[model samples]
Target: MNKHDFKMGFILLLTLCIMPARAADINAGKSKAAVCAGCHGSAGVSNNPMWPTLAGQSSAYLEKQLKNFKAGLRENSTMSAIAKDLSDADMQNLAAYFASLPGKSAGGDAAFAAKGKEKAAMCMGCHGQELKGNGQFPKLAGQHPDYLAKQLHDFKSGERKSGQMNAISKTLSDDDIKALAEYLGAL
Candidate 1:
């Protein structure tokens, strides 16, 4: 084949390969996330403190978490069950839908902020300086204290497995987790 023709074919193939990453439909995501609204809230804020808010979370982080849940890399019974049935497109769309929504700032007790700040210093490495994480790590600021504590507890107990978080949580006391959660929640 001619060089120009070969280049054109290669470009077409590359575009098709990358299409799935760009095919997320926000409207479809909204529709699909209806089921998710039961726990994660209609607008991505959870009514229950035990459930984590999905709104304003990075799309990449959300997508990674959902994919991990489906793959059994992250262990949560409810999330695993829910994620198992989701197609890649569904997960992508859901991430987009939730990320598009406004996030909530559930304030925590002021008393814990000092201790939490000290404890959170270690978290700044991966979760960002302000805890408003990038695409890989999740945003911790403005999250629910209960949910954050639960996740930290789970990480410590080996229930939820993340290499860095597991090791970090292992050294934290109950008070540390509580303080960190409270501080982050208020941020």
Candidate 2:
């Protein structure tokens, strides 16, 4: 090969070696996630109405939340403490394992769901037409109404801060929050 071609090949090889590989291991994630089974369930679904289900959530979203908790950007007593000890790879693995599972429906009140559908129109821009989530947005469908409502309340009250959520939640009343939660959870 010419000297120029040899130099280019060497540079490419060096660049490839310097870059970090980000492939997550699902089995490793499952092993690491055993501690989460108490609340998040063995399959990433939560039976309790208060805890949000992790199943089928986007890996990117899950990883971000874990990072947020670890950094204190998001606050949860249990999660923060747990996340504090996790490495970035641990978070990625856990997110991958959970995202690989199937999500379950929490069901909803018909009347409340009807009202919620109207409000969800504005949410589609970020959350997707089906509310299954986009890049970092979470899947609202099949989530628990109580958990969804609490998040909305937190956003409205400034307990949880998100540029979009905080502003949008401010426009909602208690009943609106409930209706939205019911509608989203049933999907």
| Candidate 2 TM-score over all chains jointly | 0.91
Model 1 misplaced regions, further than 4 Å:
1-21
Clashing pairs in model 1, backbone N/Cα/C closer than 3 A: none
- The global Cα lDDT (0 to 1) of model 1 is 0.91
Compared with the true structure, what per-residue lDDT tens digits does model 2 show for residues 59-116?
9999999999999999999999999999999999999999999999999998999999
Q: Compared with the true structure, what per-residue lDDT tens digits does model 1 show for residues 64-159?
A: 999999999988899999999999999999999888898998788889866898888898988899898777799999999999999999999988
Model 1: which ten-residue window has the lowest total lDDT?
Answer: 17-26
Q: Report the Cα RMSD per candidate.
A: 2.8, 3.5
RMSD of 2: 3.5
